[model samples]
Target: MTTWVLLRGLAREARHWGGFPDKLRCALPAGDTVVALDLPGNGALWRERSPARVEDMVAAARRTLAGVPHTPPYALVALSLGGMVALQWALEHREEVRGCVLINSSLGRFSPFWRRLRPASYATLLRLLAPGRAAIDRERAILRLTSNLPLAEGTQQAWTAYALEAPVSRGNALRQLKAAALFRAPAAAPGVPLLLVASERDRLVSVECSRAMARHWGAPLRVHPAAGHDLALDDPGWLAGLVADWKTRVS
Candidate 1:
């Protein structure tokens, strides 16, 4: 059986993938399995201290995979902060990964605004901007910052609920922010097949960043018009079909 492992972004839980696995299972050929993982310090692993670096997260993922019945050679599909972890995994364990899909993420934090801000300043800004009740009310703003999709009523509600239920702690959020600011792609690219998916309207990581990674890795690219950073949630069917088609073409 073929396995596809889905990884979510920083402070996000496995549930963030939402209906994506089911949609992909329906779309993918028989014998393919979709596995959604909860990174350390988030979701099912929330009790753990969020790792400060990509290497620690990679180690946790490796340990998680080790518990699975199947071994190595899986497709990795990751988003945002998860994409960073996925990229590092593929770089260090290329032999274990058959394919990789990085969605709405950059090799490094793309914004000069973010890069210029000191970690303390960034953390303060984030905390100040993300106040209670107001945070829920600012769903559109949050979506704009986090995803490439236009905010719909349902999307807003769902995201707000997620934020309320699994609020990433300030410390963890700051750690992730710092990590993003400092991150850089490895000198050597992975040998496995790669797909770079970007949201044209993404306010977080610019589409140009995705394009750069694609160019650097010689990976195929897919751009979703008007889709915000959370492309999978916005249109899981589209993403599933794209992955299925890529699997067929690559096979």
Candidate 2:
């Protein structure tokens, strides 16, 4: 049985994983466990100042995981900025990380700035960073950029409530962005089995970036036909199946 530590992207809390965590847990082999930990300055820790570097974020993640009763050789399943943190963690703590599954994530060393962040979303990202925006509007904009699914009214309402309940400060948001932009993955991939899952139609980050990284690492790359950046949101079952299959092959 393995300990699967799940991580989310900027300003997104563990709750943002929606039903995916449950799905993955059910799909995993017997006795395996899934745990989602909030990065500093998001969700339960919204008041904390987020670090401006991915390495520090990795340290924060390690601290959060210290309390979980999990065994070593942990499997890391992380998306976007969380994937960046996972990469750094795997590189620095090879003894603890067994393997990594990165979803729609980009590293500065492999991708150009425009590809790491699509130029088309520049205005949307800037608007998301603006101060004093209503919670509902901000969440709606985020949904638009992250998922291809037509959000149900209930989903939007729920996200609005989540955002209002645990608002991320503008400062923390900027710090997270800085951390992502500054993160530079090593030229060589981490010394662990890796699986790369990406959305071919991702708008926030280019799919080519994932393809390039997979090529560099000689890791298997699975492409979703139409999902956006939030591949889990768009197709949870498919994501789970792919992950389960990868686990089987690795095991």
TM-score of each: 0.85, 0.96
Per-residue accuracy of model 2 over 1-251 as CA lDDT, tens digit each: 89999999988899888889999988999899899989999989888999999999989989887877776778999999999999999999999998999999998888899999998888777655655547777788888988997653477788777787888888898999999999988789899999999999899999998998998889899999999999988888899888989999999
Which regions of candidate 1 are displaced past 4 Å?
109-141, 147-155
Residue-level lDDT for 106 in candidate 2: 93
Clashing residue pairs, backbone N/CA/C < 3 A, model 1:
147-228, 147-229, 148-227, 148-228, 148-229, 149-227, 149-228
Candidate 2 similarity to native, TM-score: 0.96
Residues 1-251 of candidate 1 have per-residue lDDT tens digits of 67899998856678777678998999888988888988776766755777788877888988988998867788999998788888888888888899888997776533453422323333324642464565475555555556544444476778677666666666776676666556777646778888889888665566777887777667789999877667887778899999889889988
> How accurate locally, in lDDT, is each candidate?
0.74, 0.89
Model 2 gets an lDDT of 0.89
RMSD over all Cα atoms, model 1: 3.6
